[model samples]
Target: MSARDWQKSSFSGEGNACLYVSAPDNATIRLRESDEPDTILTTNPTALNALIRNAKAGRLDHLSKG
Candidate 1:
């Protein structure tokens, strides 16, 4: 599929350091930091949903600190 448009999270407004995502197809989700446009990471919908749920539950904050 063609590269899709990347959009930063609305919660991360006006920042150079933020997560950007391109949802080109339902089967895959692409993600990259705004500072690293050349490198793209892909994940499945199920894994992405789990990560989102973890973030909402504050499980990711522990990883960020260490």
Candidate 2:
């Protein structure tokens, strides 16, 4: 695997919790948090878009409940 150029939102503060995203290729997306750099999550574009859409619509909120 090659090194990915990770990017974070401009609104992200200079803190350890910032989320970073990268495109390893046209078909793959990579995600990582600054506090846990060694752990990365991968998915395809379609799945990622679905996640974002569902998140915005509060469809995934239940998963966060304790």
Q: Each candidate's TM vs. the true structure?
A: 0.75, 0.86
The TM-score between candidate 2 and the true structure equals 0.86
Model 1 stretches astray by more than 4 angstroms: 1-4
**What is candidate 1's TM-score against the reference?**
0.75
What is candidate 2's CA lDDT for residue 45? Answer: 98
Model 2 stretches with alpha carbons more than 4 Å out = 1-4
What are the C-alpha RMSDs, in order, of all predicted structures?
A: 2.4, 2.0
lDDT of each: 0.83, 0.87
Q: How many Å off is the CA of 14 in candidate 1?
A: 1.5
Q: Which tens-of-lDDT digit does each residue in 1-66 have in candidate 1?
A: 234588777777676788888888889899887777788999999999999999999988988885
Q: State the lDDT of candidate 2 residue by residue for 1-66, as single tens digits.
A: 334588886767997878988996899999888898889999999999999999999999999999
Q: Give Cα distance to truth, residue 29, candidate 2, Å.
A: 0.4
lDDT of 2 at 62: 98
| Inter-residue clash pairs, candidate 2 | none
